[model samples]
Target: MSALERRIEAMRLFGRLVATQEGREYLADNNHKSGQAVVVADYEELIKDVMPRIRSHKPPVTIALLKDDELLMFSIGPTPEAERVSSSAASPESTIGMLYEAACQTSNGSSFHLTSWDRDATAFSMPSVRELLSH
Candidate 1:
């Protein structure tokens, strides 16, 4: 599969995982026990494992993982516009934490991360999260 496909697959898997009750409980329990989250590392590992398959077919769309305020955001396409904004503003080190926030939120959790995914070269904006919910 192409990189875009791989990334999409990963996202879909993650989305499904996060949307489950068991996964959310496990993540919360682990976080409570460890005091620090390991999801970021796990996410990185997953992407790394899939990269080879994706690269052979096509390069993945350039996604910029971002932490905006309290939101975890990612760009979802191969548009120059998104790339420019991401490259200009976000750094690699921080993106993981941002993504983690989103994962945590989506995992049947109490809160929602305020994230936006803007398509490159278009006015369309994809918000990972819609509203903030309190537990």
Candidate 2:
């Protein structure tokens, strides 16, 4: 699939994962190990709130949703030049790790783990929901 198509599919998969109680629990459990942020807010409400905001932005945007106490924090910005630079480097794994670290910094001292979804070479190493659950 094209990169955009892959990203869309990833989002759909993420939406489906967050749509169920089991999936949410699994995500919460996996947060530490996977470093992907668990959506603490209502998925539908989050979509309603973010869609319009996302539409106003240009392409190559990065959106981060973080959990702080009882609130969900949203940080939307352009995908950094570092990301483009790192992706072209020899190690995509390191690039993904760097991205996750950058996302985590936005937590503002919140202890929750963070994750980024991208259609890069690193995507090949990501485990499926079933794979994550099986372990």
Winner by lDDT: 2
Count of clashes in candidate 1: 0
For model 1, how does the per-residue alpha-carbon lDDT over 1-135 read when each residue is reduced to its tens digit? 443444455455445534666545543443322222112122333333422332343221223222222222232223343234332222233333343444344333212211232222211122343232111
TM-score of each: 0.25, 0.31
Whole-structure CA lDDT of model 2: 0.35
Report per-prediction Cα RMSD to one decimal: 14.2, 13.7
Worst 10 residues of 2 by lDDT: 118-127
Backbone collisions counted per model? 0, 1
After superposing candidate 1 on the true structure, give the runs of residues whose Cα lies further than 4 Å from its correct spot: 32-135
Put down candidate 2 lDDT per residue, 23-132, tens digits, no spaces. Answer: 66765553322333322222222333433444454432333222121112223333344443333222222322243344445332112211232322211111236443
Score candidate 2 by TM-score against the native.
0.31
